[model samples]
Target chain A: MSKPVSKFYLGVDIGSLTTKVVMVDEESRIIARATGRTGFSGREVASRLAASLLIELQLSEKDVAATVATGYGRVTFPADREMSEITCQARGIYQLFNKAETVIDIGGQDSKVIKVLPGGKVSDFTMNDKCAAGTGRFLEVMAGALEVDVKELGGLAEEASDSCSISSICTVFAESEVISHIAAGRTKPDIVAGVCNSVAARVAALTARTGLAPDVVFTGGVARNKGVVNALAAQLGTRLLIPDEPEITAALGAALFARDIAPKNKPCV
Target chain B: MAEQRRYRPLASTRQLEKTMTRYYALTRYHRLWGRPLRRPLAWVTSGAPVELLLAFNIHPVYPENYGAICGTRKVSAKLCKVAEAAGYSQDLCSYARSHIGSIMRPDLAPMGGLPRPDLLVACNNICGTVLKWYEALARIFNVPLLVLDTPYLPGEVTGHAVGYVHEQLKEMAADLEKITGRRFDARGLEKRLLLSKETISLWREIREFCRAEPSPLNAPDLFIHMAPIVVLRGTKQSLKYYRQLRDEVKHRVDQGLGAVENEKIRLVWDNIAIWYRLFAFFKDFSQRGACFVTDTYSGGWAVELSPGDPLESLASTYTEIFLNRSLEFRARQMIDLIKDFNAHGFVMHSNRSCKPYSLVQEVIRRQVMRETGVPGLMVEADMADSRVFANEPVKNRVQAFIETLEA
Candidate 1:
């Protein structure tokens, strides 16, 4: 029996707040994924990520036939192909949940909701770039104020009985509101749930404007939170589909896009 | 002629300057001035043809025009209240608030429904906010909208862009023709072009008069004069009006009248005018005897490529505008304004709602101040959304700013 041919492709997502990297085999299976805070040097971070991932996977650099970059810093990355995060995320979500009609991506610093048509075209989208209220940063700040680890806050929020209502849309004011709620003897679980609900409400309002469609998938770092996912699903009046690793969608999409452009590597075909 | 009587010209520079000073003194800060256009008003705004509505024989109302009115009337706060009530945060643009206020309040306009637009055209050229603003109105009023996509003409206005804009203009004219059931006569276009050029020439003369040591007109009065250009563009009446305005300004210059009540420092205004806060901004600068001797808005008129070449020049102007151009062009434009005005310092309003205008303002401000020795200050605010207007902070900054300029 002959051994099957093996090939590797790389995807890089250089965003405003985080640098996400992903590697995939010929069949679009995720071989490895890594993320780091975007330091002052974007190029250096990208090169280091590529090297680390290659070393960890025990794959030589020569095995990677094509590399694609996406995100705001997509063009900044030294790669064979550069694609917009919009196209990459849309492609990524479509690959995972073929029935997903909408993709809501909430990242470290910003949030965007993209509506995908049946044919995989982005029909409409809304992005909240002007403010930091409806983003992962908001959740991080709320978690710090509540004196809870961010990773565990989701489960705590899910256990809350009565979530307090947060009225302030400004993140700064919202933080103060959370502190006041705590001072007023609100439960930690309830306040945590409230913070998640506030973010969900803002995202829902934005997504509602574009008219939400079903089989909605939440992609990005914020999607990992159970409380936010529950509130968003309730607000959207639909089940929220989340991938096993939501944040790696853009990078995976970039890799898939790279494979499409470089067809001679029939191993993935 | 009855309507024309109300449009009385600003008779003298002293009178214009005095009115400006008084208005600024009274209009403490930029705030909203009217009620939000309710569903009915939205119907009025989005319903008919904007051109025909302006011809309403009624005074056409532009939110921008009303912002100027609020500035001149010195009562923008009342209008701003409407937007604040709707949970629009203070960080939104003041001008947007003023318009929203005007729309919400029917009582603000006493002259039988403030000449609402039969049609409203909001383009993405100036800012992306306008598209959303009109979209909200469209849902409320159900009016047909015409979107003119002048895609960020990548580089300088080239022949290809000129051709593209001309094609859009031709299509627009055809649409108008279909709506109005009237063909666009070439002769009429010629006549309109001639009047537009003549009005532009007179407006230029008025701007030129500002070069005098003590500029004859203040920013507030100049804000009022902006009406004819914006509303009556391409009309003989507009040309005649500007001629009178230029003559009045020229007379003031000859008499050595200062733009402010008292002659003081000359300052250059950077960025688009804070439409909602026009009075407050003008008052803040002028009260300290700081005359806005030049502005980026006024510099746009210098691109007159001629009457026959208007289609091309107009296209060029659209593509080459400060908002539409690359960062380098904007930096150069600021440098030129600073030098041309021989300004002592500059005020760059880092407007939050306008990203295209505000994105590289910090970079330009630093570079120009370094090169020209003109100190540049960035005042944070929204151009239209009144919710973002923090009077105390702005006032405190202005006071400190004047002292720095004096020093």
Candidate 2:
């Protein structure tokens, strides 16, 4: 059904809220990519996604020379090696934009600011593990509070005439702030814009903890939201270089690592 | 998973367990013989001057150490909840919360809660929380609470600061004399101070053994083995335990054995051990060939006794602990440990309970990294509370930190 493949690499990133899988050729070309909601079990979802993804390319698991897993569920997923999302993000960003000196990744439950050394090594990183204030989960809660779809938040925010102040960085507290804003007759566009600006402000503080260096790359699910992208850019006073597919960059990076480790396993030609 | 995970524990843990068990057992049943022996048990903070308690023949018990026991036993959440339900805010120190919860509900605490105290000594050297915590204890027990106000030293330990603490010591000694019906003798404290000095020196020597290429001991070893040092610091039992520990550590260093199976990377640890997940947490590092060669926490007990007579030295020693020092001193301490231990990196636990230790850690981490040119990572968690430690998230951070170090 498809061209015969000699060697291919697989990468799986089973994050908290989503599962992504990518297949790459010997030249690191992305052969196929798939993503899903990662519902109950990331491991099962990852395995199923990989199975269906392989069939789409008419490739079997045997064609995969190596596998590397990265993310919250990476340890449970069967792979040749497990890497941290930070390392994989840096790798993916470096490969796409070689000049990226900093990476700000806002995932489902946590946000991180990574300082990348030459060649994509993570020289320093600071993550907000204490709370979910500056993450996608925070946005999800705010959207639910406003009775708006999370995807529509960006479009709605772009129409705001005035930005209502969401004073609290706490998800629960900020939800109340949004309710008060709604009760005070604030517009939906204004409230949604305030929510995005709040996330940007929280993330901006994290960058201060780890000094922001330029040619910055923003990755992860939240990077898909253009509202946050614009707000974060304005907050940090720098332009962000976003990949074509932000959510799958970590999976691509893991696949790149799988490529690097492929030669040690049988011939990766 | 049903089978419990076993670690390569130090050879001296048997002695450590025996010493600690006996100490707890004795403290547990102190009500049986304490009054008859005229040795009133005094509940004290971790940084309290215990040698003076010994001089007065007063048995001292540590609630902070018992909080650690509750944490390691995995009952801190149950205990802490009891305290929180009783109006103690969840924001309070987990140690204080769990300990106070034990007071409200001893059935949930280890050793059925520390033996009831006849007096309480609250020292502010370690943290300001102890003052309020001990005052509450005094209220609950209706015992005479002795407060030792150690001035915060933004720089070196000043004569004025030491004098201020020395006056509180005199007042404390007088209070002890009235309670124990005995005269306070500066000369009588000599033997206790000597034993404490010798035990601390032995601990220092044992820590120095970790300077070896493949560190003979990891931070967990130091944490587990330092129990006697905390509870039985100024006694023959503690002295005996450290002697065994020192020799075993020396033997490992001589034979080129490492606590971590493959010690490829060496790290210096900051802050208290995550007691509830101690083994499970450190295993993440050790399995990755990262051995915590040294740490700032257990070494808190190994501080040198200041040069002075017993009282003056006690004033300075207790006042100058790492937790009491300035940010510059703390950053310098980490930098020195990194250099002296030849560590690849350092990790600071942004402990939710320890405000003093965790507050300035970011600044200190930045300073340490700048001075040493090595990366430092901070993990957010509570030392004793399980509710705050998100397992998957913590694992993610540790894995990333280990990868950075490996690269």
Candidate 3:
């Protein structure tokens, strides 16, 4: 790993809930990846993660050719360029699955569906309004109401044989609906499945609004949850492709953007 | 943020300021002069038949334009809260809420709010909110409410619709005669319509100047310069201002100057300007060499006055506004704007307050994009209310749109 390389591109995605970093070589291949909670200061977390990853690879600052940052906290992070996560996510997804024409990403604070062109260009897109109902934060709130771990809700939903309907789209209202379902002696597994279906339904509507294409790719932090993926697939009536590390896709795309800008700006170090 | 390339400021803006300020001053002091001169002041909607009001010698004031002032001054939030505290829902048009709020607390308002009105005039051509908004004004000011209900046109303007609207205009003339104590002046109406036609031609020509390779004017320039055309339409002052603005813009075109330096992307904007962030929002695009060459909002006031009876022209022109038209018509307008302006793309403001303008924008965006073979971005934000705007996400959408255009 300590090859004393002359150029390395870095991509940083400081999302609402997490910060992800990916380092790539000159060939545009990912070399090293890192992820951690964004905490109160995404800038510091992103800097720390990127620095540590560089140290682990036995490279110093001078070895990095260029860097691009994306996500909510992108502006605060020091990078050669800052880009929107929509383009970053589409680029990352396209790199992984070239057949991906549509992408559905559910982040902590927002959900978006992107129509991606070849080479990861964003042809069109739609994001959820100022609401958390279709996002990862909604999942966290419902999991808390059910006294279940957010990560474990997926397993519970996967095991549920029957589902309770969750109709409220507001996160606060939907959480109360979950509480009522629990009070009415609905099984926790069934309620969890209902919550998953609610998120799926919300995102599916956004996908339809953008006019979904075949080979839709599901991404973002919430894509790690199998239950929502299954429900969203059923709602879309299409096979959904999941990347190995969905949360890091935007960071990967940022890396690709960095690579795009690096050759012209190679450091004289 | 890079080496400071920005919009080229137009010199006509100084004249524009003086002209608008004089109009405001005249309205503000209308109580003193209008009362002594026997000129009755009327609070009117943007789409009201103003030529008819001018025929009655009525001093027309626009609450919608005033609402834009509050928004531009960044006091809409303060004024809107006053209305919300008085039980107005947030879903109501911000202009109506802010105007109502200003009336409630004049001290918090710019220019101590608009002067009291002798009567209220509203037209439902733009939106249904104006009917209710003007009704509220009538109750507050103890003035008579005159409404012209232009039936929504699902297709082209019909004979029945025109006749119905023309009858309403004649009835409105009767109402104005009663309120202003002046008999209907048909010659005066014709004169005003002729002035309106010439003034609007100047504006359309000014907009057409943007068809040049690098547009001379941006959306902000249009939004700022459009004040007279809206409130002062059918007047000599309005026509004079447009003539001056047209010359200045025409000069820019002759000199090969652009509003956005280098003007890499020329875009057609849909819906109202985000007044609170007009310059700041457009600055984002201008900094990246993207210029809003033209927009549908400002162009709404630039429609040609029909070449017929003054009353019939007023009826058809006011009723056939872009907001009153169907989605297909709106899409066609957008598609035409993109093509005529030589725009790389278009942006639709999914305004929370203006339902008629924003509700069908996605459908229009899709249709326009499909036909035009260009990308369209839908930005969700209110025209006057900053509370509904999520800046980070909006930047994300805008940046991605620009990036896609580059690709």
Worst 10 residues of 3 chain A by lDDT: A260-269
The runs of at least 3 residues in candidate 3 whose Cα sits more than 4 Å from the true structure, single-residue gaps closed, are A264-269, B1-5
lDDT of 3 by residue, A95-187 (tens): 899989999999999899999888778889899988898999999999999988989988999989899999999999998999999999999
The ten-residue window of minimal lDDT in model 2 chain B covers: B1-10
- Return the top candidate by DockQ: 2
Candidate 1 residue B277 C-alpha distance from true site, Å: 5.5
**What docking class should model 1 receive?**
incorrect
Compute DockQ for each candidate against the true complex. Answer: 0.01, 0.82, 0.77
* Whole-model lDDT values for every prediction: 0.68, 0.91, 0.91
List pairs with backbone clashes in candidate 2. none
**Against the true structure, candidate 1 has what lDDT?**
0.68
Model 1 segments beyond 4 Å from truth?
A: A1-269, B1-61, B70-97, B108-113, B274-284, B298-313, B383-387
Off by over 4 Å in 2: A1-5, A264-269, B1-7
- Could you say which candidate leads in TM-score? 3
lDDT for residue B243 in candidate 2, whole number 0-100: 93
Better of 1 and 3 by lDDT: 3
Candidate 3 per-residue C-alpha lDDT over B182-272 given as tens digits, one digit per residue, 9 for 90 to 100: 8999999999999988999999999999999899998999999999999899999989998899989889899998888888998999989
Ranking by TM-score: 3, 2, 1
